[model samples]
Target: MELLEANGSCSNGSLLTLSCLSHRVVCQVIGNADPVWDNGTSGNSWVTLLETSYGFYIGLGLAIFSSFLIGSSVILKKKGLLRLVEKGGTRAGDGGHGYLKDWLWWAGLLTMGGGEAANFAAYAFAPATIVTPLGALSVLISAILSSYLLGERLNMLGKLGCMLSLVGSTVMVIHAPEDEEVTTLDEMSSKLKEPGFLAYAAILLALCFLLIFYFAPRYGQSNILVYLTICSVIGAFSVSSVKGLGIAIKGFFAGQPVLQHPLTWILVVTLVASITTQINYLNKSLDIFNTSLVFPIYYVLFTTIVITTSIILFKEWVSMTVVDIIGTVCGFLTIILGVFLLHAFKDMDVSLGNLPQVLQSGQQAPVTRDDKNILIEVDNSSIAPEDKPKALA
Candidate 1:
């Protein structure tokens, strides 16, 4: 309005003439454009600035707090968690089974601690956009561990589906948008700077295991201990991977003073606690469900967690093309469905202990259709001595 009045410029070359330009309106618009920090206002406004300055800290803080709360709740609720180890040992007919299971759980927890340290460090140094995508490694690690340690069999279709999902995830990661800011070699001179990709992959694997153990039983109806053990290892690897990624990005190794680093301490402590809780909870859940049914649900839940974290927290997908997003989501969905199918076909009637019975019988068990045939045969053979067919009568 002031400019217009000074220049005496009005309906000369404009799309529409302002009926009456007012100085007050211009002042109001200008006032609204002022930055919050510059406005000199006090109160809750500082919260936003604080969050922005320490956004990475906030993310790791939330992750640790949430893990603690959840882990503690699980341990407190299921007091019979150790029973799972005993049970597994009894099933295996090895007196040392309990000791072995317990040691495995401990090792898993240690690995998880390492992974968490890496994860928090990574989060502190880089955006979650870069960190969370590394979680895709979990599936690969879990699959390998399940096959080798647990003797879980994967059919051709399941193997194919895993490969496809991996390809899709790789494409998504490769095409992901990168931040314009660059970090030079000298900045990352700390001990935490080593083992980037390997550490991140380990963290993803551990987290995946944790998720699978927690959710597989309610839906999959498979063995919970097997799933839990697998999940624990995966979770351990994921946390480790996260820490390694941080080191790699920053290119520094803060050796000798690892525990002194706040982020490192937070990651390690939270990760260990979380993995222990996960193993305990998973062991309990396996007693309640079959593994195949349980694992698929876990996968869906994990995908949701990662994708949600990626979008809302890091805005990883803002620059992604629609095709890439669709392909990634579809691939995840396909893997989930494939896991469900695997669980559904797993024989629920026969426990792991009863495998010999199923094999030695050498005949298929009677289904609903078989019952109908048996009834018909009995009726035909009996012939009630006087109630024969009408034609015979």
Candidate 2:
């Protein structure tokens, strides 16, 4: 061991390789220097050199657990709404405050709040990319739960979609970014004020202003995307602010005097404004558009924008390998495809039970009346039926 306990600084101003008893641990390196390393142990083997801290795993676990809670909360909320309908009270869909009085709704809200709190804590420990894509898990959870809990039909495609989301999520989590650009509130403040982020924030705000004042007043009702777009755009800003505020919170809990810093207040104000805007516009979109349409679109846009913003703000992509990057993209695409299948075919009656018939028809090369009936049923399944939902409530 080097006897320089007073100063652990490296002479190169970046790297500090420590010689322990068994091996040398590279403690620090600048930028993307540490993400990948050729250890010269074997040919054609590239190892991802993560510091492998426990904090990252903690964040990942919290993010995953939050997804389950959030997913369950959706079922609870929907149940509350259904119960209100049974009681002959005003429904929330019609701007009624009756759901506020329902215990089930409050339970759902509290569950969601707990999930959000877990997610908030997750941001402090994990990279935004790692935490963000994991939201897909919540969608999968909701689909599965709704199928079982709410008596919603999940066709074979939906089941396949859930599986795809799982596989993709696993790939994404495995290849997710591990490094944090900012560790302390002071460092986070500097990152927030960086010119790149400031420009992004300015341009985003301008776009929101035009969309809200001009486009929304004129065409928002006609085109639901306008409102959803606003929600997605604002979501990017909200996520970044969440990261900053997370750092402030983490520092504060560690007995650091983060409250005195202007950046702490700045992050708080930005978080509140952005989160409020996102929720308001999102609620508007939900009220106007069918939830089946809103969910996939909002999730896709919100996640994509947050990812882009994270790249610019935290520079997480700076440490990514080409293979890891490709894996992440493929994983995200898989998740999107899964989400599309799950929501897009929610009302369809397609199932594994019909697979054999389809295969037999394909192999026999005979267009029988049974086959024609199957084709007709397939065509008719596309139209949504107006029927009371089978609630497990």
Candidate 3:
């Protein structure tokens, strides 16, 4: 059973909370609950979930919570981000902020939120492994949105990445594991009591924070603080929503007493915090990077964070063949690399095929040694100044 750590870094606040929600926590909860299915329940596959009252409730609850968190994060992050944008612009010598700004910001947030919500919903219903790869769809979504709304063009590499993501996600979806019988509340809770589970959760949480510490200020093309905050908030909420669904399910079977469970409280709070963080990151990223590149990478990292945690928490691969395990990991890594390559294009200033034409048009483009690096750094330098996000296109 997966056992996530719970009690280290209690001083770290949300960092601690995130650690507690790891897949190990899920396993610990299940094991502790000592759950028994409604009889004739199959293995832990999705199909089995449909055969019982508890499974349905649990799955449904997760789905709803995931949707809620995703939706909330999108709106909150977009609004918060826009405010930052306006503040930045006014400070940076851009003036005359008005209704158009609000309109544009809200509109973008809503659209982005909807897309994220769909992806989160998918995650709740399926395993993170399956849901994660499917998130590649956001690439295509962002591309279309950029072309139609932002007037950005996708060159050959961009188009290739989008198509590959689509094809790969489709394949992964078809091959995802089926659901099984619903596990009881006691089973989930009991597992949390284990030492290993708590240890693992703590370790994962530490790693997450470490990444936040290192990455938020160092490397991203966008605002680091904003990026880290956004990631933290989104992850916190997404994880919480997932836990809340689990609690609600557990409560349904073993009396409403579980409604007041500690895990439940953790879930709710995490969901809110996570959403807040996501908005912060999105707003900052929107300023420096194209939506096509930023959103996909954000989602990719989000998925990676969850699924990687899940692997240890549940010991999810105990039943898998060696080949299957290797293949699954390789597939996930490929998607990550593909996403990186896809986003790399955004770093470049000129579109590949149109480079000659643009030169002929006599545009004094921001040319330098590796124009992409200049774009990323100049944009990044403004991140900490707290301003309205500049459009990168």
Candidate 4:
């Protein structure tokens, strides 16, 4: 009887072990069969929804605010330079680096830096297509400020440019592509390695090197195109670097160890170098050229390059419907037309005959024929002695 009971216990233990193994296998099969169990789709969908809604609006708001700050900063800097010139400082085009010590200059620099910081933060949350075109607002703001504060003229065409810029911006905002989800440094690195992006980067770098080393010294001061070329080409890369660093920063704060990634540091370095170069050349251009001319031309070139770079790197257009793409193109063309108008018609009020008068008189010619015709012709001999003394005094 004892032997039979021991056998029974052994058999029960074996049965229990088999039952546990079978249950584990069944659970594994069910889990494997379910597509959502480990696919990560649900999490991605949630993030996408959040980004498309509040994240986009926040970015757009920040960009608009940045435009105001940056536009104001440009005017302030110009004022500071003018003040320095009044104080016996050299002209900006004459290699006058003395603006460095001016308090107002420093203030303007600080303000610009603040605006750039806001723009940088904006990139982390928004698509570049939206953020970049909205930058045209800066041109409008600068034009307005130049008219009011700097006493620069904004002709009828410039006003039209401002309106077209607004219209284009509105259209772009409405049809802007959704922000691409970049959750990790590895993902960004992968995108960077794509053949299209790699080619674009190589071409940009090569062109920048040629412009800086060869063309800059020869034509930089005389030709507006030289400075613009350098800034716009390198600016495209800088924007990409900004986006990369922004993503790394976002990830780092989200409990990821993204700081340890090499790509993050690379992007940081690229952004600093690119921005410094851009500012240096931009200041040069501003110092030499008219604000109205510089702002619109820079906007057209920089926006074009940046948008092209973003489209290539982020593939923002891949998911867009054909209609959206067409609308974006139309909006962009409108902006280009506006810029052309600004450039072409900026001096419409100045007549061809007035050119010699302005040059000879060393002053702007009167805008109206009545003012020009009202010039007084004084006869000194005909004036009485007492009146002569009063007039002389």
Q: Candidate 4: lDDT of 225?
A: 84
Estimate candidate 1's alpha-carbon lDDT, on a 0 to 1 scale: 0.41
| TM-score of decoy 1 | 0.39
What is candidate 1's lDDT per residue for 147-252, written digit by digit as tens?
A: 5554555444445545654564455444544431222222222323446534654565665555565655454355444554444344433343343334333323
What are the runs in model 4 whose C-alpha is more than 4 Å off? Answer: 1-52, 75-110, 146-153, 181-183, 217-223, 284-293, 347-393
Report the lDDT tens digits of candidate 4 across residue range 196-224.
88998899999999988989899888888
Q: What is the lDDT of residue 147 in candidate 4?
A: 83
C-alpha RMSD (angstroms) for model 1: 21.3
Q: What is the C-alpha lDDT of each candidate?
A: 0.41, 0.71, 0.48, 0.68
- Model 3 Cα shift for residue 158 (angstroms): 0.3
Q: Return the top candidate by TM-score.
A: 2
User: TM-score for model 3?
Assistant: 0.56
Q: Which regions in candidate 2 have their CA more than 4 angstroms from the true location?
A: 1-18, 21-52, 83-102, 355-393
Deviation in angstroms for 145 in model 1? 10
- Candidate 4 pairs with clashing backbones: none
Q: For residues 162-234, could you state the per-residue lDDT of candidate 3 as single tens digits?
A: 6666555544444434342114344445655568767866765675566567776676554543464446334
RMSD of 4: 15.3
Shift of residue 123 alpha carbon in model 1, Å = 9.3
Candidate 2 similarity to native, TM-score: 0.77
